[model samples]
Target: MPTLQDVAREAGVSKMTVSNVLNGRRDRVSPATIARVMEVVTRLGYVPNASARSLSARRSNIVALAFPSRDAGGVTPMTNPHDSLFLSEVEAQVTQAGLYLMAHSVNSVESTAHSLRSWNVDGAIFLGTRADEVAALHTAYDAPMVFVDNHGTSPHISNVGIEDRLGGQLAGRRLIEAGHRRIGFVGPRFDEPGVVRERHAGFVQALTEAGLSLRPEHVVHCDAGFDHAVAAARRVLAAPQRPTAVFATADIIAAGLLKGFVRAGCPVPDQMSIIGFDDLEVARHVSPEITTLHQDIPGKARAAVEVLLTQLAHWPAARSERRVLGVSLVERESVAPPPAS
Candidate 1:
């Protein structure tokens, strides 16, 4: 590969002048000079060094994607679709800006904080991590970051997420419309800020409006991975007074619920109506399908990247800078009115 020096020598211009032309910094150089530098660069097949360019601009040009884990290690299968969707969009947007993305998984505070600092990441986007965790990172590294599918108590952090509360409310209202008076919820019970809390809040809001409540025994809490979800679903479904309808907070848990129900010979919608969040592709492909709240993964990813890039540019953004994308209820074949006594 031809270097900037080689191009500069060929164009009879200083390396800085050649650089300004390649990186679109053309204010200092005249149009004729820029045209000359570009012609030489093309003739020499020269590509600018990204690291040097980023150093000159005092930016890393490298962002991170963090997935907070629990006891279960590795990427959660339930989260794969959501992750892939956002990553694909993130990668495309970052590439357009001449930047790159670094992906990491964090299961604890110590590891997450360590990775962020050690990696020297310019900025980060938390993928479905807790708001509190992301907030902690903000305090520790003081690095620019964007949160997706999470929230926090502080006003400083920028978060891009679907209206999880609205999603929950939609699911609850859908179940109510389907005549399910006795309802249940399945998800993590963490007090930290996150999608679970938002969706659950919405669930409670809608249930309250419908003169119903999520019975204590009916609400299931599991760790943030697969095995735990499967186990939790079994216990919840095995209860004597099982809920007529169950709203799983994550699509993965919902998938496990579907499998468990199948193994127990429990017909879906016929025995117990089901609803879930995230609108993962499997949510629609599964047998009987699933009624869910549609969250636009690509939109959230694009917004988060834009926020980080805006902050990277050191521009004045709106206060709080929070963005809550819209959500809509996806009606499918899974839900129905509870069986008459």
Candidate 2:
């Protein structure tokens, strides 16, 4: 519905300036101006004609937004608002760069390679992939690769991730400062490398620094959605010595936990307090506002695109770097001091 004129006006730049930025003519525009134009483009949801633009560029100018399959059938669902917002920003960048975007949900190395080679892909940004797997994909596709939320280190890969461990520490310290000791952590308590695992590790480290410990029984492992969150919370509720507070590593999970507590008649902040990560839209809309850790999805998305584009423009010599985004705490009505004995 929005046009180039709208984006140009919104970004307070000339039409030519907008065009230069959108067409990947980086030398003609300042970094600050390019960032400004891209932000406005995202805000206005400006989608240009991909076919016409790509032909003019000569390059296929197609970016692959890939992810590992969530289910057994190699289908990854893009159902979360956070993921949607992240993708929305990435789409903005892709459009600004005059590129066509393609999405793929791949489960195996073979399938992933097939998708990359099958399409006229210039670059790829993937979710939930490992460092070694990233290498494998690079070996197969020979395109610029950007990975999100992967904790494992690999020199040849470009990554955009949050300081998940630091976020956990913030949540744990906040709960401890609020006078909660018997804390329950809800999320997938896995030994594998990922955001969830890093957050749990940070939380445990924080507890250890404060002379507290998270007993194995206090850890509830579950998936990242609301249904799994409710079940995970219910497990904590059933524990012999119920925790006074629970910090679900994600806001979506916290939303579920909050609902589970209410459905089970547990008084929020009276019987239990809750904290969540990735301050989602639901955090503020819920009955009692959810206290959460905030991740700058837009900023992260921008950085991820910048990394990929830089690689595309200067590959074989471009630096394979990791960009770590910061996280902050959003205190609201959910957290409270431990209930009286």
Candidate 3:
């Protein structure tokens, strides 16, 4: 209930000195004075007014973390392991940088722009946003913005993403190295212009180099959800000539496929092999731990936050930057040589 003025009066110091000490501008005041002011502040239980401080600093000290409510494939960002984990990491990094994160699931460019305008956010970090949506938001919002997992080509937009194509190639090569000739691919539509499309392209490249082409029926359209992947698994199982190995674009989908295969009494790696992308926690926890491509979710989160903060610090003078992290293959128990007839 005590105010800053009360603390200043009790400490026998000017309100400006108390303000400097409380705001961590300690260079302006002696250590002894800082200690004394802090002691009085603790004793008085005084709290600074956030609105007043923000107004004086011309910064809200808050950043927005926006992602689509449902991605192009109708997969909820929060439910997807990679997206959720990245969000957690971004929040942690933002907090460590002495800023607050406002995570929002955006449905449209208009709505997102309105929210950002209303909140007066210092900047924004977007995840799983489509290229078109990113372009629209960039034009609509004046604040510094950074995109993650977006394939926008604008020279002025900052972005952080992984080698999605290389990830797909790694997954495909692993299956092929394990002697899987008849293989299937599972993920969002391959035609979409995003991470999934890049990954699928890389997968096709690897297959073509090996003189093998993925059959149309073997390419399953499933989002990053348990039910969708489970249905895809059923379709794969019912095929007259099922693939010996399957590459799932996301770990969540792979986990669901594993569950579906179990329910159908299909033995993994013995009768069928599976490889997944994104070495998420679910990849290891599932039975016959999934072999997957390791994309650094934490690294991506760090880069996104760092880029957005840098833009915020430099404002209009900041040059846009793009960071593309690498990926690696993780061999696990889920993949093996094709079963002998």
Candidate 4:
């Protein structure tokens, strides 16, 4: 394999310049120097050492994104679309800054921090992390970190996400506008932190303004997985005071709610109305379609990359800034006025 020394000798630049050029660390070197080093390295066919080059520079030119893994008997269900499309967008954005994307699984705060430090990543971006875990991450690493859910603001860390409270409020308002008063909330319970709490808070605010209470019994909690949500939906609809309308916190749960209603011989919009969050593709394909809150997935991915790259460039101005994106209400045929007695 060709070495950095060979590239430096041919390019008439120092070995350090060759190392920087090969590893995508171009901040210290000018554009002309970077171009010249690259031209010579190409001509010489020098393949530098990734490990050694990373050690010499503080950054590895790699950013890590951590998510919870599906393991064992069951894992919490996800309502948003998988990270594949989101990661693809993030990859395209960061690649322009000469950074490679690496993903890791984080079941807890301890494990996530351990993985980042072990991999020697330049910085990290976290999705679906709880508030407590976000706190632990800050204490664990001095590297640049950005969270998607605004896991609180700080000097060293930054977060980018939409106005979840507004999104939830929109869901509640839509159900009310449909002329349904007896509403039920189907969510993954409020014990776990992050998006659940934000969206629920918004839901509460909207209901309170409409002079309707989200009765404790009407707020059904279920596991995050789809199967669990399906069972929970069945149980809720079986109750004596069957809800005339349901607002599911996730698109998956909303789909489950629809299925449960259908199996129970409940005619949607005629006997029951439903709305879902995160307008995933499944939301539109389901029977009767789903009235949902449309989240900006691509926009979220792009903003996260921009924040991380700016932090990597040592530009502190953008640090600790929270960016909120807007969500739209997608109306479908699933909602209608309450059925006559």
Candidate 5:
């Protein structure tokens, strides 16, 4: 294979001129010289040495996608539809920028820091990472980073997320408009300081405005997993006075609740109205489509990549940025007025 030196010799120009042309440093070389160098490169079939370039630049040309994992030693599951879509979009954006993407499962600060350092990644993007873990990772690693769906208040941290509180309010308002008074909320720990907590707070705000309150028994704690949500549905079904409607934090959970209720011989909307967040594809695939709050998954991915790339370009000088996108309601077949008593 022909090398840069060969191309320079064939083009009758110095190696520096060839280097500048190939590296897009156009101002450093004349257009005629650049054209000649390209002709020589095409004739000689010369290919740049990526390793040498990376070594000279002191960069790996690779970024990492740090996925939070429950099992430290196991692979993180991609069953969640929101996670899957977000990953697809991030990969597309990173690849378009000519950078490699490395996905790693992170369960602890020490282990994740070790992995990142070993890989020599230029930067990282964390997905759904907890606030405490993000803080620890920020302190442990000096690399440029961006967090997705994180609620960290640190001025040094950059993040991208949706208007979770507004989404909750929209869901609440939709149900209230449909005449649902006794409503329930199903999601992960609402007391935790994260997206779910913010959503729940907004939901409560809407409820209070309408002179309605979310009952203590109506609040169900279920992780983002489908099976757990199905079990939570059973608990809701068993309540002494069941809620006529429920606001689920995720579409996957809402799908699970739909299944649980259907299996127990309950017709959706007529018996129990459910509204979900994150208008994932699952919302439409279920037997009765779910009404949901639609957030821009692709937009969130693009913003995260853009912020991380900006930080990488500016290094330690780049200021932290937080982007909060809006959400709108998608009306479907899952919400209706309460059943006649």
Candidate 6:
């Protein structure tokens, strides 16, 4: 087994000189020295150790995709179709670019911070973490970072996210034009900052323009899960004045709501119209199909990697920027004019 020291000894040069030549630091070694080192390396069949190379360069050549612990029982962050789609695309891109990919789920902000500190990764891509928590991460780590769908108002953070507010407006406008004044919104609470908050605001904005305000009872603040959404939907439909249409913040919740509506004997679009965000596959798989605000999941994934790579290319000169992906409504069978009152 030939080591870098053996190559350097055979070439009658210093170990650092051999390292410089192997690493293509031509400026650090003369052309003649580089040629000599190459000849020795070839004659000796010397292969540089990847880990040693990375350590010398002060890099791990590793990128971590981190997810905040959503609950006590940690689940794969890809549980959300949007995250799953992003991971599928980003994993290939990261591997093809000659980097190792690590997916980590951390329960608390402190634990998340600790993981980054322990792993000597080149950079990170945070998946759907809260803006405040992300900001805390930024303050704690000096590593380059790219955040996916971080909606926090910060000029110093680099991120890729959809136009959630606009998507919300599109969904609301679509239902409004269909004569749905009694529209209800279903999802997690709007007080928390993130995509949901932005979408919720946009929906409310559109409704306000048409002299329609969402009544307190019409809003269903349920956890973003199947069973919880179904229970909430049943409760909504059971109300004395049920909404003719409902806009779910996520397709998963929308799917559950659809099941609840069916169990209650409601005919989709004919008796109750539905719209959802993310345009996940389940939206189409459902019986009537869901009309949704569609954003490019793969595009978001690629753009985040590109942003991180751009920062890595220019080490010591981090660029604080943001890229906003566009979104539009994809009209499908789930939405129609509300039935007569």
lDDT of each: 0.78, 0.83, 0.85, 0.78, 0.85, 0.84
Measured with C-alpha atoms, the lDDT of residue 38 in candidate 4 is 73
In model 6, the worst 10-residue window by lDDT is 68-77
User: CA shift at 159, candidate 1, in angstroms?
Assistant: 1.1
Give Cα distance to truth, residue 112, candidate 6, Å. 2.1
C-alpha TM-score for every candidate: 0.82, 0.83, 0.85, 0.85, 0.87, 0.86
In model 2, the worst 10-residue window by lDDT is 67-76
Per-candidate clashes come to 0, 0, 0, 2, 0, 0
Q: Find the 10 residues in a row with the least total lDDT in model 1.
A: 70-79
- For candidate 4, lDDT tens digit of each residue in 24-67? 65668887887787777667777666688788766688899877
Lowest lDDT sum, 10 consecutive residues, model 4, at 71-80
Local accuracy of candidate 5 as per-residue lDDT tens digits, 244-277 = 9999999988999999888887789899999999
Q: Which residue pairs in candidate 5 have backbone atoms (N, alpha carbon, C) closer than 3 angstroms, thus clashing?
A: none
Q: Could you arrange the candidates by TM-score from highest to lowest? A: 5, 6, 3, 4, 2, 1
Model 1 C-alpha lDDT per residue in residues 1-341, reported as the tens digit of each score: 88878988888999888766655444578878877887887688786676776667645557888775533434453357788788889989886655678878766767777887776667788876666576567667767778877777677888887888989999999999989988999887757777788899999999999898888888888654556666776787777688888998877778778777766777788988989888888887788888888888898889999888767555333344788899998888789899886
Q: List the residue pairs that clash in candidate 3.
A: none
- Error in Å for residue 152 of model 4: 3.6
Q: Which is the better candidate, 5 or 6, if ranked by TM-score? A: 5
Residue runs of model 2 more than 4 Å from their true location after superposition = 1-58, 72-76
Runs in model 3 deviating more than 4 A are: 1-47, 70-77
Q: Give the Å error, residue 29, model 6.
A: 17
What lDDT, from 0 to 1, does candidate 1 have? 0.78
